[model samples]
Target: MANVLPSFPNAAPTARILHFHDSIEYESRIMYSRPVAKALAHPGHTENLGLGVATARFAESKAPDLHLSPHRDNGDPCVRVSMLSAVLTNKALLNTANSSLKEHYPENFKTRNACPLDMGDLDRLGRWHTRTVFTLGTPDTASIYQREISRLVSLHPYLMHAVLAMTAMHDRFLQSSDLPNFAQSTAIECYHHGCAAALFNAKLSSQIDPLDRNALWATAVLLSSMALFFVESSDPEELWPLAPPSPSHLEWLNMNQGLRVIWDIAEPISPGGLFHDLAQNPQYSYFQSKMTSEPQPGIDGIPYYFTTLYDLTPLSNARNNPYHAAVRTLASLLDVECTPFTMVKFLSFPSLMRPQFKALLKGKDARAMLLLAYWYAKVCESQWWIKTRAILECTAICMYLERYHSGDLRLMQMLEFPKARCRLLRSGTSRA
Candidate 1:
């Protein structure tokens, strides 16, 4: 039998009991969390028929997946929910089930404490297992998403929930127009969103390990992507800079700062870590190397005059002008190809951004807003999570600039790129 470690060794007795109970519930919901051959009887009520024992045996025979149940949802021969009910009635039933589960699932207790997944949650997880994970990055990094992330999910429930939250939100976005039952699905997705973020935030406050560091970093990426998933209306007039400042304004930008903090904590690029090879191409290393307090101009992609608008000069650099870093960093990308690898690198720029740059964007600084509009115009179609908000918000920025800063021909001239770019995006034309 595999040794099931105590989930919370130093936790209070109540916490330990609750953790045990939740572990049992996870087994019950995920089709025999107790994958042992022994029949667990609820003290006295039912005979020990061991109907699920054979299914568990078959599951074990096939080499079960760590986070997922091995057996099919149907043909249980016994309904597992009955075991959950038995545990509720008799507190000792969990010990019986826990011992039974020890043979199969040793390290699953911590990650399975949440309420059991319904059909929708199951569907979302399955989609992630099969599809969404692959899309999060390039195929070269598939091992990180598939192998490393699964290993992390086995160790950290927060990472598991964070992955689920991203998949759920992705699923929600895909089905928003077609699914008539979106409101119901949204409620479930919101539960995932809440648990994933709340637990993740809590975990960030505590001391962590190397593996924990990886898990936290992975969760931060998902959270950042999720931050973009929750924008308000598609209307440009309702968005920030166009409308009055609201709490949601510049959320994606601010969320990136959190990602940077976790990145420092995680040291993903340091030797031996899972994300050490995040820069898939040699050319992309300029992004990691070129970050300087004193940066020069004349870079490509964003117009030369754009940086000049912020009064970026040798004396200013990033020290005096916030736009210098934003402009300089964005300029690095013009030479790199926008493959799946670079796309991930591309989206992460906000994290490396100077706080003041993001602050200026939040304050609706015309220069900052203009620069951001150019960025969105460049990458609006780079990834699915970025596309909707990027396209919509870029258009909003253009309108805001045009509406408020109309007389300035320099600002108007700059608006032309993002305006034409967003027009192409909405028209379904590919920039590449």
Candidate 2:
């Protein structure tokens, strides 16, 4: 999978960095999810697709109706993948993997290194410094995640473990093949995270100052992204909903919800805290603004086909409708423009989904899946971590809904939009 990083995208960089009132820089991406099947022309964990502005114009074009193609009942989805990348290149990505990251994030490198580790662990830390850390957040928060958070590693050992664990998990995700090395790397990933979580939990049980609070918040963010990247299979059927239920099924959503726990406990709201900078980030503020401002009381912006599928009548509301919250949130997503800043609104759907809606999705409720599918299609190509998980899950949802719910014309009709949109996402890898 790491092999795909250097060559996949051929699209000219349509993404232009925008400056906010605060003069903060944010990058615009025409995102496509990483490869699963022929979804991306390259193999790897992140779908850093070069979907240029032209593709965005195409995304806005009316999609033709497409039926659900049959799902292959057998092997790994990526085994048949023959995508040849156009060599996805950007200034940051063009940097050699072995190059020093300190120059890019000079603020984060502490005078003292994380201690008591062998060279193997140190190598992983180096990889994080060079690549993994930079891609962890949006352009605005990337610095905070890479620079400010790294400085915290020395003061909070658990934060160091969390960073190592995330780096290891990223390495695990990048491998296209399932070798003995895959299992070994996975074990390493688990050990570091387990240690991080243990120490973190211990610290939370006691007193925490503003600095500890910031460290814990940053660690939680890393762990949360890791929790989502923990894949059961590259194939959708082999994953949850279709696969038997376990404690870990859709645990990413649970992890998403769990982030607030640390946030509430560690109110890193104190001035000068690292998280304070994160809180002030324009990307988040923009998302919260639209979320709070979108009018509700009905799924007004949601298409009639989806409204009918969910049984959301004129009289129905958040109190009685399971799909109410999810649909309402989806409407808010639709209400905004799909800018780099606004895409955060779409990616945040899982966290905002109500428990009843989440349960319906866990049960493979077709309506719920349709809603989720639409959300996935909208933002699948946007972020590295999201693209990490979105590739397979989005592909699976499209296939699953098409195969089983084919008879329901309304469901299939609504499904057409996401399916078509997802198709466009696949092509985004090479579009110029």
Candidate 3:
């Protein structure tokens, strides 16, 4: 202040401007604004931003109710949609992988061989390949948009509800628009629609009466039929009585009695007998046609099909009968170890011998005792000697006794012996 010098006001202002400009120029020299802005503007870069945001939101949301740990947040509709889409797409990927394996390694693709491949390695390869292929066609902007949408959905349940409601409404509108043509469809189409209607009605009926005995029985029968179909398709020989005795050989035999019972009860009430209805229905006509196209000849030149019954007892009882002779011939053809003489005697002699034996001993009832012994001997000698066959025979005998004698406890006890229990355990462990 003591050394005050005369100075123009404009001079001070100019100096200050110069100092500000120098600082600005220095800061500008080190900065790269254009490249940074371009990167932020780029589609791929934007997608990364969107993905990050979505992931963060998902991480913050509540877990879902499932057997496995929740894959995404409960509140995030975007995540749910993404996960569902992924699951669907994964199925397609699996199909592609299967096709590829079939094409390149046909022999290895068979059920026997395919069971042992390293699934983890295959999955990794499949994921990498699918991701690379998808990336090629996808635009960064679209990817970014999808990512952002997914994130938004993941965070908001209302958005998901709205989307689903809109979709359902649109579908209803389309369906209503086609109402005029619905009744004028062809017979086949009409039948298909009727079946669909029946199924829908059945579902509603089940929901209304959850514990309906008939409905439960129907479902059980349906499941059993499907199991039989799979078993039959895998090995047609199982359906034939000709198959040699093995641990696995008797499974169908064991199932036969239950299947018969199911058939007996459900057949009358069902639209028709299950197989008969299936054969007649146009929807299943193709499958029926395939089954009938190459009918296999059974014993006595009879064409074998699912519905055909081959009763050995009746055939064996008719002495000097052509069918009896045919049974022996069939046994020989099947390489089963059973003498025709023994088979004939077992069938015919037992019925004759038991009554006389019973009359002789009033206190012990010799006839019933003799019948039991004879039946046991016949079972031991027959082609159905396996554990499964024994179990099946036991079941069949139980059914016969129940139907004819109102459930004989003695016969039931005989069926549940320690020997049968041991056989069952052994059979359960052994495989074909």
Candidate 4:
């Protein structure tokens, strides 16, 4: 048997039916505001989908109104045109930047380079140049590119959408434009040229790869995003979810590999050494003759071009290998018998530091001072691992160095807790 309760005789009046209708209209307008079908029709719809997702994730707080209509509110067509131009131009610039880097530092670009614009050395140079040109309003293409990117990013939603749409429409536009072959070729060339121009201006041409030009541009965008992460106090975990884990083995490999290459070339020939014996032995010459004799080109050839120009070596062979020479180099630096302050400060000198750290650590020395410095600098610059690995590593190093020096108790205490706390008293009548 089922029991049913009767309605109360004295209940509040139901809300007006008009209110429900109004609510439905408001929801309908909001739903209509989103141009999902229109977005689907865009040529770069997939890329736009990614961009939209990223933008939604990144700029959610700032972008309250999601609906974007460039054609509405009497928007300037020129602004839309400019937005499209900027995206295409930027893409071209990125390609050019990579080509320039490949032309300059082919070996490092091929082996050690992470992404096209991931060259720390070149970033510093670009920053310096950006500062100089923007301050002076000079005709620096690097600065111009940077400025345009900034401007485009800051535009209204409609304009930004237009830019994104244009990025998708780029290939189609190229195909449709009835320009002469030379003009069309120039347009195509501009893509690579712009990238090269930017890289050259930043003194990063030597670190480029023709195959990785797009990756380089992506790297630049990533680095720029990383910079913004610091500037805006954004969570890196949210932005770069797949970022390398703490105590990055890959980074350690890169550090050691670079040192190993230096070691192989820099080490003097040992007296009565096997290498020397092999060079002099006539029997070894026969074996050398039996081996395939490919023409080894000098600086003018493909392989030698980047190495001779940049004095950079490949980093692939050093991965997972013992850095014995690197250890020796570090021991030499430490045996100089300088004060801890001097030693720490000396680690700042790149020529003395990288090799020294690699040598001392022997690929197992996780607490190497130079690695600590690198972690510290990256933390300061990008705040990438502030509360995670970087801080932990820095603290551990500080403690290790303190223990090693048998440091002053006061200094050690200061390092532990340097801040003073103040207690505030409440003003109130005393209870009996």
Candidate 5:
């Protein structure tokens, strides 16, 4: 008989982040239950991938109009959600293992220095990222981060572990959720060990070697990617209907700052010639022109954000002009009535913009930052974890702007909603 793994427990009731018309108040208890398929059971703690295919077939039989092709199945939101849940469970188990190791093996205090990452796990992770994660990068450029990570395999285990962990997390979405998974669990263990080892090495060494510097920088980037993947992969339907973005969402944003700090303190990758090539690409000009073709708002309507984005085109000649993309994307997001599927497609905003926009953010361009806050506000309107998370981020942005760009009239006008929202949040009136 196939063994049935426990289903995800009922998540605790969370504070309502959305507004409601509460003309009446009533007390009620709700119970939720889902049927578990015997065929989907994980026997002897092994993944039942056959079940995923079976489940897909079953779903197709019920709703043939979905046109559920095999290729399309890989991208199916439902399947992806199940896969993510399973991976997250595996990630939790890995955490428990590390905690147990620390309590039992005093000598192995740092997991990275003590535990050897399995070669098979590493290869699987690498292959997964090459097939999936790398494809998400800009169309013209060979993924700089991917190339850097691949080259560092022999030179930096810490970096490798981070990259492997991220890839493994992504790979989980490609597997069966109702099963015992090892690859993701092992990847998480490697990440824990690698992060501790790398941070310790970076801190203790007064003069950082180039390799060590690269390791730290790469770790930050990969860690951020991991966090974003977790946030992006989560589905509100299976999870909760109205929950804020997880802490991982904020952590990913913070890692961008960490990357900047790394750049300030130590030299990054030795030969970053590719950055120059990417920056000078002519495609950026085309993107800028396309953005410029869009109708501009009146100056009174905060046109500075769009104008500044236009001006930023010359700053990076070849790379995708993130400012233009962000502005244009925000316009689309505001104008469109987005569902979860459309929302996920727009979630690419952070992924597409982060790599290039880091420089602008480091420089503290007020208009650029304000536009970002606007983008997040648009995100807040979406029905996902990002909604509440984006609200918090918008509030934080308003606070930052108030501290630094208070005198700017356009910034003040742009931040009106964020300020009002922040005030409402602070008043404890928003959380139900």
Candidate 6:
């Protein structure tokens, strides 16, 4: 009924098999694999079983050499089916088990010819994200996010696809060389499918329960991260030729705000939730203290000028000004994580800046433009991969400022301050 195993038009034997076991349901199926049918085709098995005509057809592909081994842990008869034949062509089994397999199977399928060091897709991706991607922007979210994903993946297809998509992109980004043609294609497919699934699920956004709300928020965070990567990889200048009223950065920020709305709605469900802890985490406090306190700049440290540059600005005492606050926050981000730059490039100054700040920049407010230029220079120095694009942005900001406020010597001086320091702050320099 449902073609669980992928069909090759050229009839080349498949090296992969999808082994599924619904422990709670005591149900299992191997797509297009004949060993299952042979195990079930024994004497007295037919009398106690619901053997339809499909079983007889499936038995045609049986291999006599195959044997059912007892499960090592449970002593249950374990079936190892080969995907070399057309046994699971029975629509009944396929339709019944399709959804279960897609959701519950962590890797979705097992490869028969996997080498000893070859971790399956889900396992490898999950570990990598836990280690790297979680800290790419907001840190300390990995454990809770990963736990919720694993817990809810069975009941939520949207979240499952989102995780898969993020993992694919993360893998692609980390690879030094080009991904194999097949892997490249598969990763692209995963991303699109995930986005589609997420959009489909959004239709029922109103009816999701508290538990599902957590899953939704988690999915939103993952989607936002994926989108960040998407925006970074696809040059924004090319995407927004005319620079629309609401740019991609604003769209990403709005998406993040949606997560905040979800968190507000779901807060009553668990007052001391993971998201709550993340918001009020001690690390955030430490980061703030590190920012507000005086800096002890070493020889190779971020220039002493950068540490106090925000305090010297006209907006320094304007504590309530979002643009001023954002500049200070970004300065701290650079100071805290400048050396051994890893995920710093993923930190988007635009994403952190409020709409009011963005409006100031768009309106050619000289001070805002100056601060933005400084931020971009720090961004450029943070990661080599993002350097060229960041430098282009910095150049664009400086050119725009020169066009509008070239007579303002102070603004020009402020713009140059961070750029000069960025030139000096080489990568791998020890933190102050």
- By TM-score, the best candidate is 1
Which segments of model 6 are wrong by more than 4 Å? 1-98, 101-140, 176-197, 200-204, 232-250, 268-272, 275-322, 328-334, 338-352, 364-366, 376-407, 417-432
Off by over 4 Å in 5: 1-112, 125-129, 133-136, 139-142, 176-206, 211-215, 231-249, 265-274, 282-432
lDDT of 1 by residue, 121-236 (tens): 43445567666777676676655766676555544656666666677667766655421121233433444555555455445434444556677667777766766655566667
Tens digit of lDDT per residue, candidate 2, span 1-432? Answer: 011111112211111101010011000000111123123223231433211101111112222212223254145455223111211211222232113222221132223221234335545655676678766556666666666665566557567667877777667656643311112334456545654554554454344554566777787777667666656565567665566676556667766655545545455544665556556765455523422322276766776766777887777787788888778778767656554456546646775567788888888998888888788777666555565356556767888888888898888877887788766655553210
Model 1's number of clashes is: 1
Per-candidate clash tally: 1, 7, 5, 16, 6, 2
lDDT of 4 by residue, 1-432 (tens): 111211222211222212222322232232223355334324344422211101111121121121336565367887677666644544444454444434443243234321332122122223322332132111332343334333322211212222222232232223432211111222212222222222222322122223222222222322221111121112222211122333322232232222222222212112321123343455334223221122222222223322322232443112222332222233234334333223222222222333344555434343344334333333321112121223333344454445553444533443332111000001111110
lDDT of 5 by residue, 128-208 (tens): 335533433343432665564445443454444455445554445445342112223332433332343333233323334
Residue-level lDDT of model 6, residues 8-96, one tens digit each, is: 12211212111100110111111102343333334233222211111111222222222223343253223323321222433333343
> All candidates' TM-scores?
0.68, 0.64, 0.20, 0.25, 0.39, 0.51
* Cα-lDDT of candidate 1: 0.56
By lDDT, the better pick of 3 and 4 is 3
Can you give the lDDT of residue 219 in candidate 1?
72
Best of the two (1, 5) by TM-score: 1
Identify the leading candidate in terms of lDDT. Answer: 1
Ranking by lDDT: 1, 2, 5, 6, 3, 4
Q: What is the lDDT of residue 286 in candidate 5?
A: 30
Clashing residue pairs found in predicted model 3: 76-154, 77-153, 78-153, 78-154, 358-367
Residue 29 shift from truth in candidate 2, angstroms: 36
TM-score of 5: 0.39
Give Cα-based local distance difference scores for all models.
0.56, 0.53, 0.28, 0.28, 0.40, 0.40
